[model samples]
Target: MNRTDLTAVVADATGLTTHQAAEAVAATLAGIARGMAEEGSVALPGFGTFERRARAARTGRNPQTGEPIEIAASVAPAFKPAAALRRQVAAGRPAEN
Candidate 1:
């Protein structure tokens, strides 16, 4: 599914209009982004934790040119799904294959 599908689901569950649901979803995502930027992490019980990770500088080969390139360090967002969510997704399937 996609954003529209998600909006529909949330709207149905919350008794909200599609537009309102979409806006609420957007606002929630924006809030999460802002929190991650400022606090480096956001934890939602039963959902997951979104956190920042620091990537060290490294040398990488250029696939096209076969030349080495220096990769600068950076901070990146990471997500670790809650155990309950993981189990829910894994039911009747492999966990993390």
Candidate 2:
């Protein structure tokens, strides 16, 4: 679901106002971004781990022209689900530790 829907759910679950839930969600997203930027990773137990992965420079063919092009290296963010999360998804059940 989108942020608004998620905020509403959080508000209902926590008995928080909509504004407060929105702030909480926004703060949580900002914190995750900050952690990824500063430390290159963040791990939430029983959920998943987010990390920065480096991509190597390589040559790629230009699809239209069939010409070789140089691709610059870059770092990209990635996520790996924890075993519990994976299992829950696979089993179609709620996540558990």
Task: Give the per-residue lDDT of model 2 (tens digit) for 1-97.
Answer: 7999999988998999999999999999999888999999999998999988999999999999999999999999999999989999999996542
Report backbone clashes per prediction: 0, 0
Question: Tens digit of lDDT per residue, candidate 1, span 1-97?
Answer: 7999889988998999999999999999999999999999999987799999999999999999999999999999999999978887878553341
lDDT at 26 for candidate 1?
94
Stretches of candidate 1 above 4 Å error? 92-97
Q: Local error of candidate 2 at 16, Å? A: 0.9
TM-score for each of the candidates? 0.92, 0.91
